[model samples]
Target chain A: MSAALQDLDARIVRATQGGLPRVPEPYAALAATLGVSEAQLLERFAAMLADRRVRRIGVVPNHYALGYTANGMSVWDVNDAQVDALGRQVGALAFVSHCYRRPRRPPDWPYNLFAMVHARSRDEVEARLGEIRALLGAALRAHDVLYSTRILKKTGLRLS
Target chain B: MDELDRVIINRLQGGFPLCTRPFAAAAAELGTDEATLMARIEALLGDGTLTRFGPLFDAERLGGAFTLCALRVPEADFERVAAQVNAHPEVAHNYERAHEFNMWFVLGTRAPADIARVIAAIEAETGLAVFEFPREAEYFIELRLAA
Candidate 1:
């Protein structure tokens, strides 16, 4: 990455956590507030997207109010060889909004394939999992589903 | 600002309002027509450029309370636990991070107490220790895939 891109990367991360401007031209407004030219700001934003410096730029909705009352995070244990393939398949599921695999840190923990699913009720989420499990067949290993009691900070990504 | 891009970004956030003729409202604000606005949004979503054009709800406020939680799963059972967790409707997002408590997932429940109950259930079902890390202090990370 170029030095300018590296700097833009840092700025983009900062922007995610920072307050978003409540205006029509939010990006432009953000640039104005930060004292950068609107064109420079747009270019940087565009560059970040092009280089994958930023994963996505969009509003994250509140699912709870939208009848998606049950929000659960589930982890799966899959073989290392099949992790990426499974992750992409799992991530692509409409109900499974976010899915990825992280290194196994264990003693008591043993999950690898991670996915989040939302629904109107616990039953709904469970049903979705059943479908996923059935789809995975033998590839699907032991699993644990954790539910949340409170959200401390729904929005934390700050833009620098 | 280029009128087109400005309109795109402005309508992209907070979602298009839910109502008949929602696009028209957005277009009016952008000094354009609904047909054009709708077409653009459709294109964006189809191209994987935009994640979703829907409501970004605040889980806590809506009543499905949640917290950040993790577990130290045995490497062998990782897949099982993940499937079990994802099966539950309450799990919002589950992520694998670089830490001892490698498996991280967020839970949203109708009642705050259900969060603990659900964790306990998972532990009992999976026979694994769920290292529950309730938020000590809120940490926010904004990750946006640029288009």
Candidate 2:
């Protein structure tokens, strides 16, 4: 990675990992702390975004607080050859939050395609899974929902 | 949430502008005042409606490594094992899912090799096999929750 992208300007990550300030001029406030001009900070941010270092700059709402209490990790057993294409389809569904293709350990774990479905209730999640099932169709040989019983720990990365 | 709250949640999901007065700019677009907009955001975050508000970094892109790992904790030992696994600083998100392989968590480390080291540590600590499922390919990843 280029120096601009390497380590992602540690100062910025360390300073803003918790969050950017909530002030009217939050960037300016953050730049002040980092002892950099607002323009320089924004320039780095833009570069980070362009290089896919920063996924987004926005609010990450608490799904549970927003009534999306039921979160189901819907795992699907898809044909290996067609997993990528089908995974993309499953990922595009409106209700799916995160979708990825993972290595499946046979006998013990046969599911390869994983999509996270969040909804207000189990029924809603089931309904959405049904939609995903239809989308997967033949590619989806079998599937199961691993509903989250509890959140053991949830926090952002801590770069030591 | 009230109408104004919904407006803020929905609109801000896309992005917050980078400007001298971003809240003011957003308020102008949403037809609200800067103070009210800022206040609403603070309230939302304070009340746990918003979990986070800032730039979402890609750990891997930043010269770090991350992996989704699972552990098949025994039903009777779930709590104990979870505590042991979560004690590690590298473990970011951990959840108890209703399945045989019930415990799932994401591990992030500054170096790629630290992933195995962390998993080994967790296994030794919990005496449970850590099933590491690093992403072979990312089909999609978007964390937009519509209000």
Candidate 3:
């Protein structure tokens, strides 16, 4: 990408990182604020979506407000050889929101594959964890679930 | 929240139209008029049902990096340490979990090299070891929740 194009993209992201305006013509409103044509703004947005720089443009619901009070980060110590394959299967589950392969800091953190399980209550979260445990079978070496007691900050990805 | 509100939240989680009149376009598919749909959304936001309603950007995809790090803060100063950690712009998310490594946060920087520097700064500022759990792979990610 050219330096000029990169600069333009960065400016747009920095402007909207807080969020797109909640107005009738949000795109036009944003364009007017940035002093760019509505068409140019839309074109850049489309390109960003295509490249996945912008994941999606929509509402981010507060699960806790909607009764999903329990959020668990369930980690597993699956065999490294089968970790990728197992991670894929675990990720495919309906209840798991985010799943990933993270390195274990042995003796302390022995979990390599991590998955987020969210629900309305502890029982629901436990039940969902059980489903994952059953799927791992003998391959599951060890596991633990860490529940967040509080959210200190959650300002996701900001541009500087 | 009523059935219409739930339906609106479920459907509008993503793929909101980017047009001159997005509410009008989106409301048509939800079987509601533009004015009513806009009013409901405004109420939802005002009442704190929806935290945010807009574009979701990926740090890595946008020429940046993200790293998940955990800190074991002494019980006597959890809040103080959290405030210091969150003071940095790189600390995107900081959560207090029920574990020995209670303070967990994610560091997202525009440049990949900034991650190490921030970790060092945190360690120096708090005098606590920073446990960095860099993500090796992402199997799946879906941020939508039923209302």
Candidate 4:
């Protein structure tokens, strides 16, 4: 990255890490703080979005507060060769918030594919898991759901 | 959330504009005025429906280290262990999952090496082995809930 672009990226991370200003013209307010024109700041934001540096710019709702209290980390032990294809299918599901393929440890941790499902209750989560099971079919060897009991800590990314 | 609120949530999920008057731009698209759009967003945030409104940064891309770690805490020592684990600033978000390896959390650090140090400290503090699952690949990760 160019020095100028790197500097802008750092500034963007710092200025907005806390949050965007809750105002009618939040980007404009932020641009004033960073001593950049509104158009320049927006251009940099668009560039970052295109490059996948910033995932998305919008409201991040609290699932628990929004009645999605029952969240489960659904793990699946699928055929290693078929995981990539199967993972894409699982991730396409609307209820699956996050889906990824991580390394699996033998004997102790055998699940490789992880999908997070959120719902109003555990029963709803279980029902969704059943849908995933049907989707996996013969490829799924074993699976488990880890429902969160408590949130010990919750905070946004702090760059220090 | 009423119809307008739902519209705001659904429309904003795609993204907020980067114009001089972003709210005004969005309001025009949603067929509402800027003041009303701003007011509804403030209300939604104040009510905790929206945890935050801003950019979502990728920690790894910014030379930061993060990983999903889990610990199998004994039934009796769950709360004590959770307290000990939560005391560290490096631990961003920790959750108590219902499984043998019940306690799961994401640890973020300025340097990659700090992750091991934090895990060691937690193990020493709680006397439990910490299982780390660093993301090998990201198939997809987007949290968009329809209202």
Top model number, DockQ = 2
**Off by more than 4 A, model 4:** none
lDDT pick, better of 1 and 4? 4
Worst 10 residues of 1 chain A by lDDT: A151-160
DockQ of 3: 0.70
TM-score of chain B of 4: 0.92
Name the top TM-score candidate: 4
Classify candidate 1 by CAPRI docking class: incorrect
Tens digit of lDDT per residue, candidate 4, span B38-106? 899899999988877888877777778999998888999988998999899989999887799889999
Q: How close is every model to the real structure, measured as TM-score?
A: 0.52, 0.92, 0.91, 0.94
Task: Please write out the lDDT profile of model 4 over residues A38-139, one tens digit for every residue.
Answer: 888888899888987888887777787768888899999999889999999999898998898888877789999999998988999999999999999999
List candidate 1 segments past 4 Å from native.
A1-26, A105-107, A152-160, B1-147
- Which portions of model 3 miss their true places by more than 4 Å? B74-84, B87-89
**Per-residue lDDT over A57-114 for candidate 3, one digit per residue giving the tens place of the 0 to 100 score:** 8878888789999989999999999999989999988778889999999778899999
Q: Evaluated with lDDT, which candidate comes out highest?
A: 3
DockQ order of candidates, best first? 2, 4, 3, 1
Residue-pair clashes per prediction, in order, are 71, 0, 0, 0
For each candidate, what's the DockQ? 0.06, 0.73, 0.70, 0.70
Candidate 4: Cα lDDT at A139: 95
- lDDT tens digits by residue: candidate 3, B1-147: 999899889999888887889989999999998889888888888898988778887778777788999988999999889999999989989999999889999999877889999999999999998999998999867667888
